[model samples]
Target: MEKKLSFRNSSFLLLFFLCAAGNVGAQVNPADVRYLGKMEGYWTMKTKLGIYAEKWKRVDEHSWKGRTMRIEGNDSTKMDDMRLFLEGDAIYFSIVAVKDSVGEPVRYKLRVLKAVGFVAENLQGFYPQKIIYRWKDETHMDAHFEGKQGKTTREIILQYTRR
Candidate 1:
């Protein structure tokens, strides 16, 4: 069974710590994963918890590597590693945390790829079974994570800008 990364009444901090695939006749065009290269840069957001930062880079046309960090004062903690890759005609999004599964990533398949952004889903995963990305402009983006915990549903959105 998948673990609940965040409880319904708990802070969303644990989510930044972890956080996607494809099929034929699928709305998702795996080729479009390349367009995400636009995300290649250092992005950050200031939150009550501290500074939440993410760095994305293109590994190739078919892959991109990203890392998330939580910064408090002079201390910065590595939260997770996010990866996007294409396999056959499908695209996948994965998050890996050092303490979880010995750094083995949990993946979500790309289910919605749009002009503004995309959506990946792993309905059977943790607190956030869905990862949605939407870009407001060249350097502004919103990431929405959603899932159900018991009888209640939870959603967390993080707005990020070029850092």
Candidate 2:
């Protein structure tokens, strides 16, 4: 037996997923990503690995680019090249390591959008399945990374302040 969805039925499925995700629209909107502008500038946090910083630059109305680096004595080592961009009415957060590979970045789709924060998720990854960012105020922000790895569920929270 063979089955096919009629145009009306297909449209219904699309609407279903869009409503379930609660992301406002299935059609991408530049305005939806405008909140990212609040993150522009440099911020730092102290971690067991040492000091880390994130710098953001608004590339356009639809995107923002960032650098995540580890501070050393006087120089910093770039850990990742990150981007938040909109495509087809949806927002995506992507990160690629600062290595020669230049392979595909790990990407997460915006699943929840709110006034001060948003939740992005990658269903295919074994670890870091979710990345959450929130602006606590003009000078502070929180970043949360969570996922299941090797039979353990892990979540790391980092609080950064303007530097």
Candidate 3:
């Protein structure tokens, strides 16, 4: 009878520890999830030259998927497919352009520098060495790209409104 009591006590302690560990591992930041969900919608930007549209959707708890297109009059050109995911301790943005022949995605590590924005830098010695996404408000965002084209430096900013 003593041996049976000892076994039961050990089993109960083990189960208690396991449940505690599971709760610790399952804890997720609500702010991070809310930041990702904010992008899920249709956004449009219009310039004198053309119009650009982006669509974003939450894929799961840790990821958001997006597509972008450019329109000029009746012609529409697909720009790229993009994904944002929380990996390890950092957020990552991956892009695959429609005209890319390498057949591989380019990934950027997004580091949140402020309360309402994040910056992604190119680690692959590619054009667009830096990309910044900043929310102007709940309904507006500005995306800025800075890079080099040949010997000249180019910077472009696109302002987007939720559609």
Estimate the overall C-alpha local distance difference test score of candidate 3: 0.66
Candidate 3 lDDT over 1-163, as tens digits, reads: 0011122474435434433433354333335645666678888888766889888999988899999888899998888888888877767777775122476666666644344655665635466666667666788876666678578877767678998
Q: How close is candidate 1 to the true structure, as a TM-score?
A: 0.77
Which portions of model 1 miss their true places by more than 4 Å? Answer: 1-26, 98-104
Q: Which candidate would rank higher by lDDT, 2 or 3?
A: 2
Query: How accurate locally is residue 122 in candidate 1, as Cα lDDT from 0 to 100?
Result: 80
Inter-residue clash pairs, candidate 3:
none
- Using TM-score as the yardstick, the better of models 1 and 3 is 1
Please provide, for model 1 over 1-163, each residue's C-alpha lDDT reduced to its tens digit, 9 standing for 90 to 100.
1123333432232232222222233467766776687778998988777888889999987899999889999999998889989989888888774122445577888776765677788877766788877666888877777788678898777788987
lDDT tens digits, residue span 1-163, model 2: 0112233574445434433554553343457677788779999987666788899999988889999888866888987788988887679888774122345677788876555667787767646788778777889876777778778877777678987
lDDT for each of the candidates? 0.73, 0.72, 0.66
Give the C-alpha miss distance for residue 116 in model 3, angstroms: 0.8
Q: How accurate locally is residue 124 in candidate 3, as Cα lDDT from 0 to 100?
A: 54
